[model samples]
Target: MAVLAAIDIGTNSIHLILVEVDESTGATRQLRKEREMVRLGAGEALKKRRIGRKSFARGVEAIARFAGVAREAHADGIRAVATSAVREALNGREFVEAVRVASGVDVRVISGADEARLIQLGVSRGYPLHGRVACIVDVGGGSTEIIVADAERPRFLRSVRLGSLRLYEEFLAGHDPVDPNDYRRLQRHVERALRPLGRNLREYGYDVVIATSGTALGLAGADAASRGLPAGRVHGYELTAARLRALQRSLLRMTVGQRRRLPGMNPRRADIIVAGAAVLIGVLELLGRTALVVCDRALREGLVAEFLDERLERASQSGDPHAVRTEAVQEYAVRFGAGGEHERTVLSLSLSLFDQTRALHGLGAADREILYAAAMLHDIGYYVAASSHHKHSSYLIRNADLRGWTPGELMIVSAVARYHRRSMPKERHPEFALLSPEARDRVAKLAGILRVADALDARELGVVDAVRATARGGALELEAETAQEIDAELAAVGGKSDLLAAALGMRVTIRALQVERDVDQRAVAGY
Candidate 1:
């Protein structure tokens, strides 16, 4: 088992969870858990939309302390994420950099929508939620996240600036013992804000409602304590709306200090606990649910699950029919700003040629996959430079850390993409030298087809529709199926047929045959 640490720096608190995890399945047994209330979104920083000096210092110190504990536990990796508070803060990056230096950990600030998704992942992955349709409600200090998802995927997610701290500051700033009129105003404001959910609740009906974050858990903990139950046995805790309203009523009549005296109430959150309760009740009313299931799992567990999934995917990289490898290869191409339409065309034409010429090359599915990936990424090197981008393409393809495909397979794809344009493959090329005589021959034949494909789409206009390669006598005829006369494409075909001819040991011919229009928007262009 690997030791993993996940740190969640929220607007109101910083949380660290250390676990010995099985990375492949994201299964974990918790080792140590820590929380520090720093109120990173408190006071003037909220108005300024930035982390204040005191809060920033506190934030850094908390992360450093947590990180130290994680390292002391010999954790394999630490993922530190900052939520809504840092996202709205102008000085968020500056504070993040300070924390990085102090804690040796880079802080990741996530959007509210992403925050909701992570919370969903945490509940689904970290806890035993099964595969039931779940509506998760996560209430933080600075914002509340509402998500409708199943056990596996999120269907809808929303984040609102109506968290406990925001509600306290916005509607009940100076109210002590919560004036009856002020409480009514708060309730009306909450109802109006969440009214939009009536449509979503009807559209995506949920099987069960799950509540997370300190507010829901704190109240649940208090409820459990009053009933002589263990507070730590909070997960899967079920609380009904009527019972929740009873607790909210008790808090409404007491001052913040008096509320803190309640069992399971933390002194730091006593003031805004009523607002948290209000948000939860608002969600229950909107969804017409009687009870909510509280989950101790939240964003921290989500981060760990996501991190492990990525690592497992990359470690077992292959062009398996699952296409995980193909997806990763495309991500690299997109990352470098390759033209989409051109890449698709080249890939289509090259694959078509590979299929039609199957009798001649005798390459396996694995090699054909290498050719497909190469065609998709042939021109990505243009992001570095337009001239001789073929060389750049090879370098990138050879160096790409794709999920699937071994080093030898990567070299073949890179080599084929490298020779798509200008120069012919030679004995002295180091990348070519790495391949065996048989593999080098395969690369040359694939490169020959790619060269013709790239030339066919030189204009970046979607002109050619279908392509076929036929063996006739001592020559290989390459036909372009198109409705419009493709003089430019044919002319390009003439100039780039030398490599094809050499690979096939015969002359190559090109012709355009008129055909009906067949176009796909996603199939516009590729090189």
Candidate 2:
């Protein structure tokens, strides 16, 4: 069992969720949840691309208090992420450092795309997408993330700069009852932002539209209250477009103080509820759907799901660490149309080389796994274009949402694949430079091995059944067991062994051994 806390610092508020996870069964129970409206992006913060002094202080204080609560609960781990507000602010890193100093908690500022993916992960826990393609929309304070996905994976993911607080502050603030002109401008802004998303909706139609985050929950709660239904009972609630329109109209006509007095209303959200309703209603109309399913699970819940997933993955690593990673890599390779016998042959050779050179490289099983994944995916860039396919392969590996691999691991794997054919890891290369010194060294060593393995399969005929490496003094000699002549493969190795030699600080040489055809055939068959 493990206790975990996830905190989401947003433009309008900061949220915390404490979950107890059963490690053996992979079950999670919500222990507690908390929210505080700090308006971190209040006033001209978003407009100016900075957090205001007051908002910054409020955000720090709230995070410190939340950290205290998590510590009191004896959470095994706490993960905090800041969304669009801090992500876009110029001084966002400053705020993050301040929170770290005050609360002793590290905060990760995620990209809008990652935020969308996590939201979908969290929503899947509460509401199953089943076999249907569902468009999950998270109406956040600084941005809106839309993901079109099914039971398996997401098809489309996008983050628009439209949000309740963003729209409210940009167009509807300072108005008692929303000005008709300002309302029109807000609608126009929303329409423009959602136009591309609407195209996706038309292209990849959804079976259901799922809405998440506080804005959606508040809108659903308000709709339920107006219909004389139970209050705060909005989760899994199917809020219809017509009801949302009705509520939007009512909100536009009422003052903030009046809206605050309404039953089931959250006074903190009163001012921006109108804009929130507008964004949701726009999405519903675009989908041509009657209603949206409300999911209270958003970024914070997504964080919890992620924590549990990582924990479960770690637990599995003890038994068979490569099982999940291999599956995820193979799945991605197949998806990109890069899987075949040639890739299999290269993968086999890469692993053999990685295992054989363990003493020289001083890399462990984990590094071998990294080499395995990179070898399987090194040619994936051919899916994009044969020219500069290596560069394309790097991009795909970095961007593809492969499970069981952390962001850092993905970087290393991608770097290894990238350098399999092209230039070595240089400090000038942006992607290589971004990696830590340790990761950069790992990539260099692994890529050096992968290049030689790939070269051994240069003909894609798997002629070289196996290679035995001998390290003598400062030079390494490879004996290739094969019946057929391998002049081409030998030449390929000569060109590719430069990296390996440089990485291992040794001279490298390879030669093929010609045995009886029957004996060679037996060796190959055994391999």
Candidate 3:
């Protein structure tokens, strides 16, 4: 047996693991797994495309602490890696040097595809797939890595920028009690982002799916999924999508405070649970798999295996073009300071309204995703020139080298961003006329929702909270829930809702609902 330690510095948190491995039997015993949320990707990480001073300090501090713990455990050698945020940060190298000096642990920043290969090694050692077709999915804070493996080697792999903390802060922040519509919208966004992967998964079918992440652990460990499991079975807990969705819905109904008190809920992950659910459910939907086995073994475990066995290493390089493209697009947006609170809040509102009023528009999940992407990228044109930014946005989006999107889908995202603040969609418009009839309609529908969402956050004053949309007597009723006055938001929505009204053939009415301040979790006994 060999004693070893591993560290993973992720976008959302930092992790350390100490383990003893028996080489002859290929069995491993985990002595300890420690995690702390440094949130290295928060603050300026995403918005400014660099690790902020405060977050950088916290990250270095966390690494030093993890190193100290490994020493206490008498670990032979500690291997560490930084994923997602660090690799993309401008000052990422600076922090890496600090970590080396403070902790004496040299940390390597691995690429998404490389991360997938390591994950495969880690999972195989822990679960032993037995040469069957299996899919290993590791959902990190800023990225999700998926690998399809036969008994010996990987068949295919892909990584996407759909992480729980990133999604939570970007799409559902400040919503104390998340609206059901927003949750559904987040699901659609994930589904859309993974649409290309869905096609690949269909081609290379698998016998089983495996997941490794805090969100998966939290969801699988919940009473709903783990109520009657055997002792020490958390590593291989089989969780059904239906049960996971049920837990997600239940969590959505409760606030952060209420969720923290629930048994099996990780208090550190309470806030980002919804975003994590999005990634899990998205993968499930894409694979057409009903359930996935949870693996407590993760990147850290993979790192240990790598140190002990060089034969475990596979895959060509650390990066994939598609994964890199996703990062580039996000970085391009932040370069213009386009991904502020206003853009994110508007995206949530747009998605909420689109989902709730689906009956009126007759749009499906794919169309809903277009709305979300548009909401995220709509304001990016302002980076070019403030005047007529909507037109410029259309041009910039169309010109960007986006990956994992078909030509038609890219055009749809471009069209939606274009029409977000401009004249109504018309057959005479040059770009609008290029799409097929169905695609054109989708663009119009998504753009209409985006208009209303943009209006709700007009001037970047987010007074609106939850929104519910329903059709009544040739009028669309949109009820908003907030503690602050929404006079400006309402006034802005009036002008912006014109396109929405025209698209749905109904006038829009904006009203307020009194915010619910309390979640009576008295029935929920604390753990």
Q: Which prediction has the highest lDDT against the true structure?
A: 2
For model 3, name the residue pairs that clash.
Answer: 131-151
Report the lDDT of model 1 for residue 383.
69
- What would you estimate as the lDDT of candidate 3? 0.74
Taking all chains together, each candidate's TM-score versus the true structure is 0.60, 0.61, 0.57
Lowest lDDT 10-residue stretch of candidate 1: 518-527
Q: Per-residue lDDT for 143 in model 2?
A: 89
Sort by TM-score, best first: what order? 2, 1, 3
Error of 3 at 154 (Å): 1.6
TM-score of 1: 0.60
**On residues 19-49, what C-alpha lDDT tens digit does candidate 2 reach at each position?**
7654433334456777788888888999999
Residue pairs with backbone atoms closer than 3 Å in model 2 (clashes)? none
Error of 1 at 253 (Å): 0.6
lDDT by residue for model 1 over 1-527, one digit each (tens)? 69989999998888888767543222244566678888787775666798878878988988898899999999999999998789889988898899999989988889998999889878774343323478889999888999988655799999988788778867776788988888888899888889987798669867889899889988998888788876544666799999899989989999988887887776567878988899999989988899998876789878876776676567546434334765676567657755244565676677778878888877777777887788878877876788889899899989888876688889999999999988899989887888899998998899999999888866544467668788989888988886555788899989987888898898989998886541211110110
Ranking by lDDT: 2, 1, 3
Better of 2 and 3 by TM-score: 2
User: Which is the better candidate, 1 or 2, if ranked by TM-score?
Assistant: 2
Pick out the ten consecutive residues of candidate 2 with the lowest summed lDDT.
Answer: 518-527
**Cα lDDT for residue 431, candidate 1:** 75
lDDT of each: 0.79, 0.80, 0.74
